[model samples]
Target: MQDPRMEDELVIASSPTDDGISCWDLHTGAEHLRYKLCSSPPHGLASVAGRFLASSQLRNPKSSASGTILYWSWNKPQPEVKSFPAEAIKPLVSNSQGTYLAGGGVSGDIYFWEVATGKLLKKWHAHYRAITCLVFNDDQSLLISGAEDGCVRVWSLFLIFDEVRRAEAKHLFEYSFNEHSLRVTDVKTGYGGCNAIIVSASEDRTCKVWSLSRGNLLKNIVFPSIIDAISLDPGEHVFYAGGRDGKIYIAGLSAPGASNSSYGNHIIGSMSEHSKAITCLASSADGFLLVSGSEDGMIRVWDTRTRNITRIFRHTKGPINNVLVIRQLQNTSPRTSNHTLASPLRRHGAPLPSPLEKFVNSADENAYVKVFINPHTTSNQHLDSSYITVQTMENQIKELQQQGSSAAAEVDVERLKSEQQRSLQMIQQWKTMYDNLHQFCVDELLDPSHPGISSGQPM
Candidate 1:
């Protein structure tokens, strides 16, 4: 099996089914592989470098078959590695180098493991409720966690391994934020390492940006609905917040009115197209595309310049819990073109009308009538010579009849006969009107009571 790098692919995961993980080519949007797992992932999906993928299953309510981590390679369907941590994990993350894996459990404890050996590196209690989100800093040195208890904590990996510092502090967290009054839904860190800004979204209907350098709340922006996910802008100037209101709000990290934005209080703008609550968000490295997943099972790719959807990928019939956009591997190319083998899309029932039908429906009915009435017109000349030619129409009717579409051929013949009759009637009416005018002129020329003839005595 050829190992693929995680950066070169777009990864997606869904729930309530055995076939869940799907990988697609980032450039071409062609699906490379689909893996069927032992169970649906609840804590979300992670790619271990480019060699394999990882998913965490929720513990089954009726059976003891879940709470397992499943790993799959690019070319295989079954998991290469499966481990049961004995606790149901909800949020999973990988280090920048993919050397280690970390998961947050329902018991509010975090577990770290070496990806190669599957050996447990560290496990500790971090929160009072299930962990909702986990993110690593740019260098993977700091792990940020959010929980249902509304506490956002930052833990340092260096300190986690220090035996001397471990004894000095009662807890290992570098900073603990308790501003949120509801469950924290998502958390993201900005560009800088230690000086980076951390933002947390919550069920409290607000997103807060905390300064890791100063250990203080930098900004708090409230929304109209509960915010579920957030993605930072490329420049780290503004962050996009997705909420239950089906809108993505752009909140500035700087102070209110400090930037060139006209909107005060850092409420810059919003992009609303999703009909359901957004569940997750991932931005491209260049920030040209912002991908968002919703409870409606739609993944929309937005152009940052226009703030409009550029492409849409429909996932399975379940709420999309995770979305990831990474760089395409430099060494790997797309396996297929989008025109050949496209990604699997969940299409709605009943296909749409063809383009020809759509164009006819959008146009005024009288315009088509005018074209048939005046076949010699410049606009209809091309169409008449090509599609409406007598030979062409006859050949098409014959083909339809040969294909057992006698009803369709009959309808076409009737339409053509009616059009020809209407054209002949219009021409006949125009000739009749012309003849009547000519006869009236002749009668007036001979009439003596006509003003010009009667007054022509001087001539």
Candidate 2:
């Protein structure tokens, strides 16, 4: 649906939290959409408008599975959004109007595209290593990018536009920083907090705030673990940073003095809800409220001012790889609505399950990644496709029996029904006896780390 107030609504990309994307209708408390990228793990996502969303998949281009960019048009339900092969363009950011998109991929090649025309606009061999993240300023004039080579480069997109028209270089700002023993994960520009200030994060367990004005280093906020993801807050007082240790760190930002290590920021507590790493985080427009997503597939909304968790959402099944908070609507029904990114309806403040239970549940929920479970052999399992087939066959046999066929035909139907009934009986027996099958698999994978999994029984 088109936004009535011209503010784009929320189209959350969910998967098992394991891989791919399932778009949830925030209004319905249900996931009515899925975007299955062929063979690659999806990395980043941004919904520019009501119906248009772009995603980045990370995989080897030469391998059987290649990294590709996907464009989704919801005019058709989310499932059919054809992902065109974009082996070269690993997406990073789309422009304000969603007309232009920017991303860099293998070979540190930075690129942008005109979304409607699908034409390559500005292109450059931007880095030596693969590009990690890219973002355009709110004005769409400057593009900030980070690469695995431990360098952050800023490009003047408008200047490039002029060069396209008049052939000149419009370079804006560029900086190189040491990953200091880790890979750079992401870079973001602070538009509201400081002029020409760009923030970059790396696996070095630190988030750095750079002063783009004088081409100088500023402050370094040492984080607890390898920084997995970092997002700049609106109103710029603080920025949210999370690590692989499953904690959300609120690093307060300040105008730095001449010193690079000038203790300019404070750690404004953290939201440590997940058992594993936090993969994604975003903030509301005011910076007073923020949300974080993790490999545990949970979302927690935090009140930055009070340092308290407002609401915790456990809507996704597997790992949540990407999260973006767009501030188009305010006080938009505290409830999940079609037009917003509010928290999903769930029993709040339920004493968090014991840490062990959380870990065990995470293991079970994510076991489908490589270990396939058979519902016919396990308790509290999803109905396998075979169960559907069996049920369908049994229903057909019953229908034939009720048709009042001849004696020979009835006998045949009765034989088929007897077989199905026997199968169902056996299945029920196993289901009751093997209720611990899922728990056993989860325990092996998560805690004890099984060397090999085996049902060890004939199907």
Off by over 4 Å in 2: 1-11, 14-19, 22-43, 59-65, 75-88, 164-181, 192-194, 255-265, 327-459
Question: Which residue pairs of candidate 2 clash?
Answer: 14-22, 16-318, 17-318, 17-319, 18-319
lDDT of 2 by residue, 1-459 (tens): 444543333435443223555544322334444555522232357664322456655555554236556555433333233333334445457665545556676667766654443445456677778777787755556677777777777665534545354354344344455544565787777763225678888877778878766666677778768887887877777787888988777677764433232322466556676788887777655566667777787776777777687666664367776766543223322434543344211212111111001011243543311111112121222112221222345557667778865754766778899879889999998997787897876676664334443443332
Off by over 4 Å in 1: 1-11, 16-19, 38-43, 61-65, 255-264, 332-459
How does model 2 score by TM-score? Answer: 0.61
Evaluated with TM-score, which candidate comes out highest? 1
Q: Who wins the lDDT comparison?
A: 1
- Alpha-carbon lDDT, every model: 0.70, 0.57
Task: Summarize candidate 1's per-residue lDDT along 134-169 as a digit string, tens digits.
Answer: 888875678899998999999988778675798898
Predicted structure 1: lDDT: 0.70
